[model samples]
Target: MPVCPYCQVEMDDDLDTCPNCGITMIYFFKCQRCGQEFATTGILKFCPLCDADLSEQMN
Candidate 1:
């Protein structure tokens, strides 16, 4: 299972992206506003906290 860095919530590890925050997988990603530690596969673009767009928020 995967853990949401923003909320520390448990999620499915196979998720290519987070359903709640839209974060990727593997790489280190932190909520720009809240400063939470998350892993991203480098394919998302939203903070999920303040709903801000990440570098890759859209597909």
Candidate 2:
């Protein structure tokens, strides 16, 4: 799992923004299940690439 360098939370490596700290331009998310990468403007509940339930992983 890729960790948010700022928030220190386990993040989906496919995302370019930290779900906890909202950091961008550096951090990104990669799907733990599908290993797909994507960008985000805000908190997402599911992965657009694989439709993974991202909310459950946040906690």
Candidate 3:
């Protein structure tokens, strides 16, 4: 079993969706503000690294 970062819920390593939160299990960094963890390894509007809006950082 693996722990989900979004909700800190436990889930099967091979499974796709989370049994508790219903979020798709994936590799991501959680955003401190919205509590939304996003996928990495690609360009994203937010902190796929943390789900933080990148536009805010651009300032």
Best prediction by lDDT: 2
* Rank by lDDT (best first): 2, 1, 3
lDDT for each candidate structure: 0.65, 0.69, 0.60
Model 3, span 1-57: residue lDDT tens? 777778988876566677888877444455667676556443345764444665543
Model 1 global lDDT (CA atoms, 0 to 1): 0.65
In candidate 1, which residue ranges exceed 4 Å CA deviation? 27-59
**Per-prediction TM-score:** 0.37, 0.43, 0.39
How many residue pairs clash per model? Answer: 7, 8, 2
Model 2 TM: 0.43
Identify the superior model by TM-score, candidate 1 or candidate 3.
Answer: 3
Worst 10 residues of 2 by lDDT: 24-33
TM-score of 1: 0.37
lDDT of 3 at 21: 88
Task: Give me the overall lDDT of model 3.
Answer: 0.60
Write model 2 residue lDDT over 2-57, tens digit each, in one string: 67777788877577677888887342466777988766665577888788877765
Query: Model 2, stretches more than 4 Å misplaced?
Result: 1-27, 57-59
Model 1 agreement with the true structure over 15-58: per-residue lDDT tens digits: 76778887655665666667766665654577756766666523
